[model samples]
Target: MSDAVPLLPFVRRDRAMRWAVGIGAGWLAAFVVLLVIAQIHPSTAIVDLPYLVPIVVAVGLSFAAAWKTSGRTRIAWVLFAVSNLLWLIGEVIWVFYTYVFQRGPPAVSVADFFYLSSYVLAVPAILVAIGSSGHLRHIRGLLDAGLLALGVGTIGWQVAIAPSLPHAPRLADAVAFAYPLFGVATVTLLAAVGLAGRHRLPAWAGLVGAGFAVAGVTDAVYAYTIAKQNIDSNWINIGWQVEAVLLGLGAVAAIRRPEPETRQRDRVRDLTAVPLVIAAMSAAGLILADRLDGGPITGGTLAILLALFAGVLARQLLIIRDRTRLATQLRAALREQERLAITDGLTGVYNRRFFQEMLRIEAERADRADSPLSVILLDLDEFKKVNDGYGHPAGDTVLAQIADRIRGSVRAADIVARYGGEEFGCLLPGVDEEVAIEIAEQIRQSIGRLEVAVGQGRSVKLTSSLGVATAGTRGGHSLDDPDGLVNEADSALYRAKATGRNRVVAAGMLVDPVYADPDLPIGLVWLADRIDAQISVHEHSTAVSRWSLLVAERLGLDMAALRRVGAAGRLHDIGKVMVADSVLRKALPLTAREWEDLRRHPDESARLLTELGGRPDLAAVAAAHHEWFDGTGYPRGLAGAQIPIEARVIAVTDAWAAMLADRPFAPTLTVDEARVEIERGRGTQFDPAVADAFLALVTAGMIGALAEPARA
Candidate 1:
């Protein structure tokens, strides 16, 4: 795994190298000039401090080398690469000048030869490093070739350093030239190759190579002058130093100029040797211990060095071990956070959000596996009543029980979720419609039988309506169509609840009786069931009232009963909703609909229950409830029980519920008015028996607890 960079000390070691090299070059230039001047005036070599020349030049070279070396580059690579390029040019020129140009001695010291040839192996190794920058990952062959060449050159240099038999002067010249020649040849060849592969190195590296070659020729001329005793060589010495420095700087610039490989390798330090912090501490302790030891701290300080080294080693181990453990723990934490984001809390089911995510996944799986999947959705029936009556805590308990039942009923492979407040969903993988239906039915029954215990020593019986939708992976498939599973299951669930309650229904096309003789296909059966259920549901709303004629249709109360019931139920002091219990329970009567409306009950109820659609049966019977059989009604008039059965029945019941009601209607109507109203309404208003039946049902306490006030 890759890591982000840590903040670290930013010392420009690269700039340091340039300073050291520049300083060293200045001093070296003066030395070369001194030597040239001394050649012109031989006596000066003896009279002056000629020896001081080496010292000054060496100091400058060391400073320049150290400073230049202080950069962000690898010390080994610089030694191996850049230094070699400089040495190659310098040695070839110097050798050619001293031995080849003026018919001078061809012999060369082994020490000199060994020193210059070493760079040949060095340059390519670093170049190899600079080239293998993962960006060129496809060029393994080129990288391998560079590495191989570097190895061969290094081994050859080592072999040359071995005691080859001493040679004659001329042979030595040829051999000496041979080492620099080999280096020159390799660099030249690689330059050609790299040029051909210009795509690899930029144009500048090639130009750098060419410039170095030209400078090499100039150095050769300067070397020839240094060898000759008869030259006014100030120009040659100055020219060589200037040329060499330029060439050296040029090579370095090319190397530093952001090659992909150089960056890749340079970025990560070789902290493998020791933890950086411990290395710092070790370096610190060494300096302190050295200073304490005073006079040229020596081998006798061995014990101190050993102890410091041990501490350094221990710190490194601690750093490595701790870092490893920290990385592992971090990864584990990341994984856990990922898990929680995709999970649901309450049902431990996936939740709708995750279901959607999984559905996409399963849709793909279905295509790949060539299988089927179905979604089953379920919602609790009369869930609001449970919340309103038993309380929300009970509602929650019911939902939990439902979720558990769903889990138990679905196949283990299926995924289930608490779809929403009162609704749950399941995804059945590799299961078709038939199996899905069976599973749905099972879940439906499971919920129905569940008993949820809420607080207050009470338990609620539960039932759920279910919808099932299915789809196959056969077509040019996609799951983005949100309705596929959703619409069907929703339609199915609607059907289940619509045909009264506690029933299952399917979504299928309706077939006319003429074309339908056979039992429906399973799907058709479900569809038909859903259709029938949907049509059969009765509309009911708060527009319903005790004496509303609609109540007569319910109880099978007759026509005259319907008319009186309608009259009483429709106007049963619709006034009360607006009236205070204090005003309503007063011993009084209203002269008109005006009096009842002031209380706002009738008007408010009418507004609140605006459309009569939901309460078709009740609204119709209630519309003309005040119309007397004698055509004495305010809103509308119809005489002699020319009213509906529901109206008549509601009239009787309304009078009864009111007589028993604590309202501002004649001191809660004594048993006498209750009976007087009952007898008085016979024929003219009530269907005598209907009125009599209401009296009996009312007296028998069938209208139980009417006189009791349950409202706070």
Candidate 2:
């Protein structure tokens, strides 16, 4: 997880680092020159008095840095400036006493007050500079640093403060002890910032941390010397000048530089192992101290060791809690991902793939137990009309509502799934055909009664046609395989739609003469069933069958010829299966190439009927169904008396059926509108005699009621 960075760009970090390096080099050079002069004259005031030059230089740079920054950076620089000024005042006081009065300053003098105050303020100033950049704000960071502080403070108190209490003066004893305590605090903070990835932090923050770390060691050394009364000319005074120069360089680097870009790590394990090392060292120090002194652990040493152990224990507990919370979240996310993989995103139902897998598994279980398994396939009647009239979103609402009703109507053991568009499947184990049919009827009624809301306070009523197939009812290839069983159920569904929709049909019990014939080849039979199902799911083929027979009767056809024409009207579009669904179901006008491909279906239909069924009369009627009365139709256009009477009658009624139906390319027409279109196409697109017969049936109130408007 990366930290959120502000969109604005900061000043280039490279430029700031270069500036810090230049200032640091100059400070290094000045320190070397001062150390060389002090070596030659160890006992002279000249060596000590020249130290004021570098101290003044440190003060000037710190004040300049303070003048150039803002926010927390400005506050830190200002603190550095005051701290350096205090050190300068302390140095001047020491000089005045040693040179003018020609003696050392008294114990706990004003110089001691100024020097101790500077040490106290420098701690928060370093802390502020570290925090001025936002990467160090983690709670675990504070805990880790606190653990280091606890360990180091335990050892510092035993080694420095305890040894000092025996001989130091009463007024100077507490003052001498406070310096090492502050020194331990500074070391803990510096360790914490350095252990955090250094390259990820601002360039100036590391410089500041290093400066404070150096100052902390020097302070601890000074306190040790004062406790032993060994205060003399040495490297300790030079350490203060080095700290001042480092702080000055840090402040200068921070003046124009912004916070560095940071990448955050989410895990606590990403941090370094400095805290563990510190803990081990502190424990070892207590053991070594007791051995050197040849005694048992003292009260102060034991108490500090116990506090260090307590800090370690608390840190471990926090890690355990974080792991527990993370594990729980991982389990929940995995479960949700598993559920989504098998479910339909739109309806929250098991999809087709899962439904098929369950069918196979349930079939095998039913075989083992010698029980019956039934499958019901439900398809909404004229579902596309709902979409064409109210939009697809409303159609989705209706499908979801119907799925809920099916779930409510079935048993809890039944598995309901959306098998495909506007089609749902239910697996009912241990249910016979009779029970399955009754359950399917109950679901059908449940859906028919629902008034699903579409939009704008408008609701639409719908009905479903269902088919049920049970195992072991009529044993055949269907009983041997799960796929065959589903096909049987689908065939029954096609019959339910063919004989008029909104009814339940059971497999092996269908009585429709055209579908019940076993003489038809199974492949051709399945193909014909699929074609009829596609065209008449909204009762298109049924209407054409009825209307064609009525028109053929009026045109003075015999009973045998009327039966043949009716069957032809139902099977004329069977060859449409060869055409891609993309062409047939398109919502746009067909191109010339697509039209050329589509016009071949009638000839293909004729060839299939003659060769497969051995019936040339039906084949002839199928072939000429699209032939116009004029000389403009496709595949050998026969005009006037050349076109067969059966084909002419079908062409008129088929056109009327298409007009009343909700098609993708055309809107559904009202009864009078269809009658007007039929009259307009009398001699051009349709046979004059067949068109007159159809218009007469409409005028006589015989077939116009079939095209009534859908209920809202």
Candidate 3:
């Protein structure tokens, strides 16, 4: 039902507006030439006919622009086009009366009807545009706009209107007075709307507003001169012609679409004192003019000055009140933001960062009081299955319900937090080992009772595994370090998962018994002992497995290939057990025979894994990892794609981990140096594609945390 039209067919619109602006500019120039010639030759038909050119072109361009404008703003453009058409009609009527009928312009003729109707339509058009922008919804904006309008209107009334009113005919006098009054109203509304909208008027709309203001000023001056019987002023006619050109250019601008609005800080608000000073100067000038004419100041002039002063005071008061209210609102908003930062957005509980801080504080307090402090880490069993079978939303529902149960099962003084994805941590102050285990059992049983609804009339029953660790209970290492407590709990949680789940396990508790193989090989047993002697062999294997899988994914390998890469990464150094311990931990550069001895480990690793059975693919990858991309490596000289892709991926990950890790022969490299080493070996010692993928992961910051050297 809106009058909005889409501003499309852009090429045509642009060309049409350009032609309109060019022609309008030319018409205005010709009008200037005609005025100069008229000063020497007096009245002529050439001047009369050319005077109508600018008006016709302005009206046509306005209608075209209105047809192209879109959105809610199209209503204002439509109204503006209608007003211009009305002005054109009025101009035609005036030309007919002056040149065709051979008579002077009439006082209240058909021309006056159309001319006055244009102003009537224009005022509401501007009001609708301002309303559509939604800037007037603010009370402060409305108040500022009203005060500004009042100030500017008062100045216009005193300077232009009152003096011409005393000596004219009844009809001419009425028309003369109406011109200045309408001029004041139109200019005030334009300025007020601009200020109310945060001084961010659209360029086309601002141009139109200025054009209307200029036209109003020219009309007032012409009306005043005509009432005093001086009607042949070329300057006044030239002013009217220029107003038409201004409006035409505004129409051209309107045909082009505007960009999306952004909130920009306006500097124009800082110049508010300019208007106040102008109003003060107008009042002072009026008083001085009256005294120079040998007359006392009238009561009307005094009342106007008093109203201006009162408006100024009210404006200042509004500004102060609005600023005070804004400050209060800002403080409340900042408090809410801080609360959100510490709380989980989805689960509505304390988050990981807040939980860590609270754990440190509680540990310090317990140390001072010489009291026992305990922590319980809980993890949901088979959480991935819940996400895969039902949906992620269902998984989220289960997590929230579990979080609620954990909160309810703990004491009032306990702190509960969602640690990270399906894991929750609870801090218990002043609790011994037995009480902490009792609380953990209660939480496990409570979570085991939850049945969450997961849409489509189906429900899921959930269970949780919990681990409890108390400070000063297991060698008292947790009292010195809060993170030590977390690790202890995490280990117990893993044991619970390894044994049957959905139960509680406390730190230092014995793991469930399983059968031992009597036929296990002594060589395998020796390998296990060496692995355990390396303090973080298990942690390094985990990091290498994760990094290899990521690189395999980037290379577009399938799931089976990914599994092979992970297996090779974990068992890459299994053959090192066959070498002597003295040779492995030498702490200096090796001799030729020592280097050959180390190089034989990869082939030994392949043979050992093959003899173990059902792991031939893992053995092959581990063996080929030492092969080079350029057919120059030991054990085998496979070149380019002749080597297995999984082995190539493992080769890059193994070198990356080794360079970043501390070893007996060399210190660990910095991250930047490690990256440079990998890049240097591309296409020579490492596959180029695999090296690029590893470097990409490093650049994305995905491997920085894993790049830390394993602690011994």
Candidate with best lDDT: 2
Q: What's the lDDT for candidate 1?
A: 0.48
Off by over 4 Å in 3: 1-16, 30-67, 82-153, 156-203, 223-229, 232-237, 261-269, 280-299, 302-329, 365-374, 390-394, 400-415, 428-446, 453-459, 470-480, 508-712
Per-residue lDDT tens digits of candidate 1, residues 417-466? 87788888788877766466667767765666667777777777766667
Q: What is the descending TM-score order?
A: 3, 2, 1
lDDT value for model 3: 0.70
lDDT by residue (tens digit), candidate 3, 1-712: 2222223333245776567566777877878888888887888565777878877877887887778776545677688778888988988888889887798567777887787778777766666554324432233343344444444545554565556556534776566555554555566666655554444455566667777788777877876686566776766877778777877777777766542231223556655454466566767776876788798887866876776677667666765675676688799999889878888877877898988998899899999988999999999887888888888998898888888899998888998989889999999999877678778877876776677888998887766777888895545446889999999999888877764466566775433211011232445434633553563332354456557876886788876786677666666677777777767878888888888898898898888777963467778887888889998986788888988898898888877777777676667788899999999999899988899998987775445333221111
Q: How should the candidates be ordered by lDDT, best one leading?
A: 2, 3, 1
The TM-score between candidate 3 and the true structure equals 0.57
Over 1-712, each residue of candidate 2 has an lDDT whose tens digit, in order, gives 3432221222234565466566667766765676677678565454566667767877787788778776666777788788878878988898888888888788778998887777666666765655324432334445566677667765676666666567524767657656665666676766565455342445555566667778778877887887777887566766766776676666656655544333333445545567867877898898788889999987766776787777667666755665576688799999889878778776777788988999999888888887888999999899999999999999988888888898998998888999889999999988887678778877876776788989998889887778888995445224459888899889888887876577667775533325443343445445665765554435555456656776776677876677777677767777788787778777899999989888999998888888886667778888998999996986888888888888888888778878877677688899889988988988898877788878877765445333222367
The per-residue C-alpha lDDT of model 2 at residue 54 equals 63
Compared with the true structure, the alpha-carbon lDDT of candidate 2 equals: 0.72
Give the root-mean-square deviation of each candidate in angstroms.
20.4, 15.0, 21.6
Q: Specify the highest-TM-score model's number.
A: 3
TM-score of each: 0.31, 0.51, 0.57
Preferred candidate (lDDT higher): 1 or 3: 3
